[model samples]
Target: MLRLGNPRRRIGIGLMAMTFVLSIFAGRLIQLQGLDSKVYAAKAAEQRVQEERLPARRGSITDVKGHELALTLEAREIFVDPSEIPDDRRDQVATILAKELNATKQTILAKLADRTSRYQQIAAAADPAAAQRIMAHDLKGVGSKHRYRRDYPGGDLAGTLLGFVGTDGTGLAGLESTYDRLLAGRDGKQIIETGRQGQRIPMTHSTLLAPIEGRDVRLTIDRDVQWAAQKVIADQVEATGSRTGSVIVMDVRTGQVVAMANAPELDLGNWMAAAGADRVNRSVTDVFEPGSTNKVITAAAALESGAVRPETPFTVPDQIRCADQVLKDSHPHPVERLTFSGVVATSSNVGTILATQRIGDEKLHSMLQRFGFGTRPGTGLPGEEAGLLPDWKDWSGSQRCTIAYGQGVSVTALQTASVYQTIANGGVRVTPQVVAGTTGENGAFTASPPAKRTRVISERTAREVSAMLEAAVSEGGTGNLASIDGYRVAGKTGTAMRYDTRCQGYCGYTATFVGFAPADKPRLVVLAVLQDPQEGHYGGEIAAPVFKKVMTFALKSGKIPPTGTRPSPVRIRAGE
Candidate 1:
């Protein structure tokens, strides 16, 4: 009854309720604007402030003496800001940019037509001069960004060993790929303030995350020695018309690789222009039957097992039949008894087999293992192969005899060099190393120490073997071609038939030569391999001469003083 009498009062009460609701809504809005303003503002800034990555420059690679091998330089990438182009002059701008950037007109037009996109790349990497020329045009949409490009100043000298970088500025092969992480730098971030037109405002507050430069790598290679080795090998390969070849030089005392070269080397400046085979470092990758060059291992085995002495007598026959297989010497020799040294000097397959008979399969294989055969050399290079050496359990009747003269067993150039280095270093097997040290951007270097050595033979045995090797380079020996004018050399020549993939049998030959110099105090060990020489295919005719040239230059350039006199047999053993 009271509500029915007071209509005005009811209307006033409803208006009051509506006023209270509006006050509560206004209070909530003020709280949100004042209390949580920073939180909302930060979220909005994150949406508009794009953080861009700034890439750090990769480190440089140098030789042992800090000569640059691989380095990075600043390059440019051309792009276009589609939204910046004026509608009236879009066609003219597209036509000029397409021709200058080597892009099609249709492609450029399409990029300029995309009004929604702010930026579009025309070319990823262009020459600095070309990029500057395009910038001189002063087109509205045209832009350029800085990038890094890899360069090799040494050219093809150490190309196979240093390798090349890929299109993405990442390492792709050889030592480049093996140590990618250490050589590649970190990427940083930049938070920039933008204007109303989506342009970066100059002098605005910018938060930057600094980048870290990569660590520099120093190799054990000598650039001069490397160039000399390459020149020698390339000339030999061309003169002999060989399908492929490799040369390696090592320090006998420290096992440091002074030079490793190969023919058909890829030029890092234009790596893609060459074939894939040219990119391979044959010194550590390609394996072949070492032929008579492997006689060093057999001779060491016999000496270590006491199966034969340097002067021990044995008969050298023209041919010897062993278990369904017939073995023959390079030249037929009269069936006469000769000293063990004479057998090795002449490289008589029959004598090697006879000595193997005394040592048997077990002792011979054990000695081969000691010389770092049938296994990887652990040089820390990519695509390194462990040359095939069948286990003793897998040896067939004739396989044993074949392996004695280096017929069945296979080895890489590095493995062969390591064998000679062991003998040169007084029978201690030291692992070969390619990297010398790694340096930080702060100019501090962490060097790699000398490799650990394991004794494989008595020092007496090493001296006897050294004398026998000297005899091999003497007059009337197979490796006489390896002799130098002023210095005495000790080396062995190898000519083994390669297994023809098409013929399914041994057809073409692989020529090889491995030896040490000075005949008394060996400083360097050199190994050369030629695959399928068109001219005469013997190691003496093809590989030994190349070895002579490289060894002579290495000794002279290293300034190693000559021993002056031929070492007496008594003096050789006395040092041990």
Candidate 2:
């Protein structure tokens, strides 16, 4: 209403103000499009293009006959876009996901409430059908992609030996860890342009690199025999109320481990839930005094060194004094004259010490070394221990006497079986192996090279010792229970004092029996051991039965027929 200035001047002032505003807008646009174009463009590209990893297919683990032990199967990875899920329906979406995916509602809700994130993984290795059921609802922001899941078809079968994998697709223990490099192949990747909602951009260039698959690992374990051994040993462990138990079955001819079983075995599918102690493969890892099972080594050494013959007579009494220690038989006995074979058959500690004295300490130590004692079995298993065997020069006064009766020396279950394997294979000690070989990308099956073999004793001495072992399992022998029907069994019993690390001294007894079938012609050797058994402490009472059961199964399954030839009776008593 109040008119003040000239009309032309007022109009010019308004025009200048509008021109300045337009100039500023133009300058800003030029700065964005030309001066800082690369920076802006890069920001935009980063927001649109996403790089994702394409996982490689892990290898399969098979037993000797191509039976699948562990393998990988296709699955789905379920994910959600938290940014796209409606705030009002977040709880409802989380509930639905929890129902279909078997996930906790709280966990799903936590992931869904993260509106700041564009993508959140809901579940990995989800069942493909379950994923499909989830996608059927056509729930916005929810999707699934292809993935792979490790499958243990046998569940706990050979779990300790085969090992398990981790969530990040790496082997965590056992053979899976041992062969990780060969089992875990190279992973690939893909870079694709995406939309604001993470949808693939149509007609946009994408880069992809395919993954390389891993090789298949073939093992020397026989599936059927392994199952039998595991069942038998597990039953025995339960019956004996022992702390733990182990069994090893090896082919004397090839030194191939047919079955290595442990009680309270690890469950491959649920390895994360198992106790640490149960996860160990005790057959190769745990060491214990060989007890009477070690007597055969003494007999072999004495015979090999020409210090004694199988029939050489010794006056064995209830006890004998050596190195300030009174070595005695397991039980009190009257003084009696018996052959060396008779002493072994009776498991007489006094008789064994007398025989060891003849060969002296050095020869016995050398023979133990040659028989794979004091050294690792070299079976390619993880956590293998070289059983303790003190040098003869380092042996204490009592150690020399106790060692002759299997008290001072420590050996693993596998090593004990290998010792018998040497005797069964005509004194040729072959290195034991679990892995047969690997199947490469070309699919050609290549066998592992022959196991290293060494001559521990002469064939004649081995035969003589074999005869003595046979007598040890006969009617008057300590391991008579180990004799199988229709198969002449040859084995020895061990009930050595257990050295407990927890108690820091001897705490309990280790019951063990190692032997082979078809005594006249040894084919397969089986060793069974029980640690800290509460039911009975005697090897013949607790361990011999386990040996019989496992050996019977192995013999039948292997299609090994007993030799028709009769076992020639070896004199176990002086008069007889």
TM-score of each: 0.87, 0.96
Question: Over the stretch 85-166, how does candidate 1's per-residue lDDT look in tens digits?
Answer: 8999888887777777788999888988899998888887777887888899888778887777778988887998998788
Q: What is the C-alpha lDDT of each candidate?
A: 0.86, 0.91
RMSD to the true structure for each prediction, in A, is 6.0, 1.8
- Clash pairs, candidate 1, are none
Per-residue alpha-carbon lDDT of candidate 2 for residues 54-119, written as tens digits (9 for 90 to 100)? 999999999999999999998999999888888888888888889988889999999988889978
Best model number under TM-score: 2
